[model samples]
Target: MKAIVATELGRGPRGLQYLDVAEPVAGKGEIVVAVRAAGVNFADSLMLAGRYQTRQPLPFSPGLEVAGTVESVGPGVTAFVPGDRVLAIPAFGGYAEKVAVSAERAVAIPADMDFVTAAGFPVAYGTSHLGLWHRARLRAGETLLVLGAAGGVGLTAVELGVLMGARVIAVAKGEAKLAVAKAQGAHHLIDAEVDDLKAAILATGGGVDVIYDPVGGALFEAGLKCANFEARALIIGFASGDVPQIAANRLLVKNVDVLGFWWGAYADKAPAVMADSFRTLIGWWQDGRLKPHVSDTRPLPLAAEALELVLERRSTGKVVITVGD
Candidate 1:
């Protein structure tokens, strides 16, 4: 097998090595997948820098989500068999030719969904669906504002927000990115590079009942000023590299709720909720309501370049690495 090995922490993507490695074998209750494609995420950079919440030991792969065919199954695994097409959240080690994952964490992808789209589906869509439906309880007919609307999770938020019947205000850096957001179902688009975010959001009328924020920092502060009374602001991540310091006084004045969400935590604390979330997302996909965007596809040898695309915010939706034919 060939894998991307991170030699040391803080070395960043440059430290990664694409070389021959021992193939992974299925352990008890686990399954070995012949990796077809893997999704690149911002967390991969954080993990390499040892800044992410879930830290792996040195010399590890950084990919989080992948899609592939099952190669083998370990004892106690009955749901999947060899040659099944599935998508999985491996937590790590997805930037390789093969990965060993728990059978419970793998889901059979729709027959019609291509491998690249399936590879990008789990994390970004799962975050938006779980955050909006389960955590925030977003009501239909409400106004929803999404920050970083052109990025991976942000784009998904815009799509799901509209599908759930909310008026979506997408905020991104430029027209091209906003155009992508519009195609994804954003009713209104704000150029964060020029327009005043707070004013742009307020201009949408009725203010904003819910805000899905993945790029924090200044945008988070601006969103607070535009939030409607009793609105919920879901904090997905700080992609802008500056974590916002929330002022409790603003929350008191508007009766707003600042909800922090981590979609990966649900896999451990509430597997049932995670399962249901996937079921709903898959249903939406089958109905043609959900379309995953894969903006760039790179081969395994260029895995570092794929991560660079995410780190530099050059790609929208998701950047996928094609691991094998």
Candidate 2:
């Protein structure tokens, strides 16, 4: 089977090479999926570099979400059958020709969703959905300030915020990236490069009700001044490679709440929350209210290049590697 393996930490990927490994077969209550596409995420790069929060063993593939057709089903797997189209957040091994995953983790895909888009959904958008509605309890007509709004989860925040009737201000590095965010439904765009983000965000709306921050660093602290009183700040990730430090005085002065939203933890603690999120999100998607703006789709051979885009902070929206159809 063809797959990308991170043989060691800090070493980049090697091109696809032939290996006579036996094909994966379904285990008890498991299903084997013939992967059609895999989504490239920052975690893949961090996992390969031994910097991700959940570290896997060495010499492993690092994709978290995969979409494909069911090739076979193991014993006790009655919920699915061969030839089912599915998307899953696997324990590991998604960046391969085939993956054996627990049937309970595989979500049945709609006939309308493309394999690439399906693979892109479960992690990035799912995180945004759960974080916004469940954690923050984002209210309609409230203002939202989105840091790193051009990236996958950031753009999802923009879309979901707008869907919930919030005034959205997208904060990103370049005009090109901000333009994409505008096209995806951001009400206002703040170019963090040429201008002051805090000023620009506050200039549009008097003060933001919620700040969806995925890029943490000095900018995370700088953006705090734009939050309104009793504001909610969602701490999604540190894509900036620098974890932020918040001063106690600022919290007391602003009277704001800092929330740490860990989407993975909810998969076990509140699995039903994700099911409801998917039903509502996909319903909006099917109704033409929300569409995932995929910016790039690279061939399987260029998987490393796909990861490099995010690692270099040069990405806009979701990036995927097509393994098949």
Best by TM-score: 1
Residue 257, model 1: lDDT of 95
Candidate 2 lDDT over residue span 1-325, tens digit each:
7877666787744432323346788999899999999888887767777777788886677788899999999999998999999998886778888889888778888899999999888887898889889888899989988999989899999988988889998998888999989988999988877457677767885888888989998678767888788899999999888899888788889899999988877666777888888788778777888788777887666788887877787778888888965
lDDT of each: 0.92, 0.83
TM-scores across all candidates? 0.98, 0.95
Model 2 residue 259 distance off true place after TM-score fit, in angstroms:
1.1
Runs with alpha carbons beyond 4 Å of true place in candidate 1:
none
Best by lDDT: 1
